[model samples]
Target: MNDRSRDVRSIRLPRWGRVAADQGVVPWLVFDEEGKAVEPVRRFLIDFVARDNRVGSVRSYAFDLLRWWRWLRVVEVEWNRATSAEVRDFVLWLSGAVKPRSAPRTVSAATAGTINSITKKPYLDDRYKPRTIRHSNAVLRSFYDFWIELGGGPLVNPVPLARSDHRRPHAHHNPLEPYRAEGRLRYNPKVPRRRPRQMPDERWNELFAALRSNRDRAILALAVSNGARASELLGVRGVDLDWGDQLVRVVRKGTLAEQWLPASPEAFVWIRLYQEEGPPLDPTAPLWWTLRRRDHGAGLAYQPMNYEALRAVFRRANLLLGTNWSMHDLRHTAALRMARDEGLSLRDVQTILGHAHLSTTADIYLVEEESQVIRRVQDHLAELKKRAQLPPPPVALGYQASDLEVLFGGDQA
Candidate 1:
């Protein structure tokens, strides 16, 4: 046993390998040390794809499973032999382990996780966030559940639920009632609820003014006006625009359903200018195009603006404005303005935002801003002080101070 342990320690461990879509049978697959696909994992991924899961989801799950496989190799345990203790240890390791970064952090340790005065964004560090850990826990449980159901892997799921009782969760809850979450993973890290941060109008104007082109201005204007997600907006085609109705068709992010949302007149005006900036467009071509071009052995050709290109546009704007605003910030700004400033109903906001549930919209935008709440509370206290300074309500319709002093004891008065 000691010699075997030494052998395991001496041998360099193999890292995960990726198979591109062009080279693989499926869209993508992860290979083990011998350059062979882990059969069960491949099967699970095939089933995942069969269920109509997105390519992004497949990639994410593949990496997560690869991590699990690496952990199993280190512990000298077969994948099917893993128990709850293994899952617990895996989660604990993730919590304490420093995630490997491609490059060293630019910010100092002291500044890491602290909000920047200029950008108002936290300087992130090389640690796994609670959300990432939670996602890993979920992926493992699902993977194990798939194998266990087929009577191939462990008898019971290794990633056990936090709930002691194994009865059906929320079995008796009303369908229309707000969902009360239950049965999270035993070792899952708790994620804090973060309120959406909206960019103030002043900062929005600064960001707007910093944009160099009409295309960027139009994208920002449309986003802030309609709350379309960056990817969704980028996916918009020239034919999706309705000039007569002033509505733009966008594919909903979660459901992938198409929806038309109203845009501001100012946004439409910018869109017109942006369209005129380029030559006549094909109706089938993408709505947004890049200014710069890359030679593809033919000539410099402009490409459709993708999410990364859109991000770079904002990255330049952020440097100019010295604010760490994101594309999602525009969505939040539009949602908040529609919900609070425009006094729209939660249902209306949900429809426009393409949220599946009305409660989701209400939960995010219905809450009062912390600063606004504090200001209102301060005003209430000032009003109380003003009331206290009033001259005893005009002496109570002619009752004198002396009479009041006589009515009660002089010391009490």
Candidate 2:
């Protein structure tokens, strides 16, 4: 058997298991319940993604691949031999353009497809959004490229990738002329950019006020003040904090680079309290502990907090405050406060965020506040009037009766 085939056979996949590296990068990949890896493609992920990407990211890719696999089975196309048309159909299926084939044997009023779990068939739905389609496209493209690079699949990749900002590829010769997609597989639609969801000061205070526990309060405060993503906050360990310097070391997602950022005084206070009141700390234990208790041979043991637990804490606060804000909103709020309100430079914000590229920081988190943007425009207009040599108007003005009448409507004026 080939290396790819061998790799697939060697994997012992569990319903909920993470592939971790010996030391670095906590979760390389996680296998989900929805997807099962078969021969070549399963092997492809083992070598390509599982050992390289984060656990959460691997889980996403697994789901993406699962969709592709199910589509292949439904359409009766072999993975290596799939044509560009078939790939397009898959994309369309994911975009909710076309529904997947369902079993006539089963009946459900909600006409969407439901799969026979025993048979591993998809009872498909046209519920996919653009982002879902784009992500699936990327995963397949990556998988196919890895396969071809290993000198396995067809010489030419079936999935054609197209230009994003502009249509068509930058290549001189386009072999896919008749197919008309060039060498590209995806035609990404322009997603309209919107301002980041930032928690207003009043709303933030209210959300915090609604929380009764110090643990939840600290968790939210740390996530916001540190500009930490959900994963980063959960992954922090007790040793990661430097009490003397008031810095907490975090593993930046995707890159796994270690960065030490300042913690908020309020966060520090609460963290200290939580650590003190929390279960007896092992030096190597995770900083955050879940309230979940299990029998630990002799006594009850509290497990380290994870992504789902952290989310549950936020969910309760959200329900209490009657707000729909998310964890990332706190990160955005922090970025907004730092760059717009606190007058921190873009570079400073970028460092605090631990973004590999300053452009990503500038593009997403550095969005100017609406009120700030209005003030800027007003200030610019006033500056332009001054520069044009317009005299400043007197503070006190005598307005004519006609002026008042025109300003308001006649009788009201």
- Candidate 2 per-residue lDDT, tens place, 50-110, comes to 4676556765776667656656665566778766666665655454443333444343334
| Residue-wise C-alpha lDDT for candidate 1, range 215-312, written one tens digit per residue | 99999999999899998899889999999999999988788899999999998999999899875678888999888777879898888888889888
Q: lDDT score, residue 182, model 2? A: 46
TM-score of 1: 0.83
Cα deviation at 85, candidate 1, in Å, is: 1.3
TM-score of 2: 0.70
Candidate 1 shows a clash count of 0
Model 1, stretches more than 4 Å misplaced? 1-15, 18-25, 33-35, 107-111, 118-121, 166-182, 296-299, 341-343, 381-413
Residue-pair clashes per prediction, in order, are 0, 7
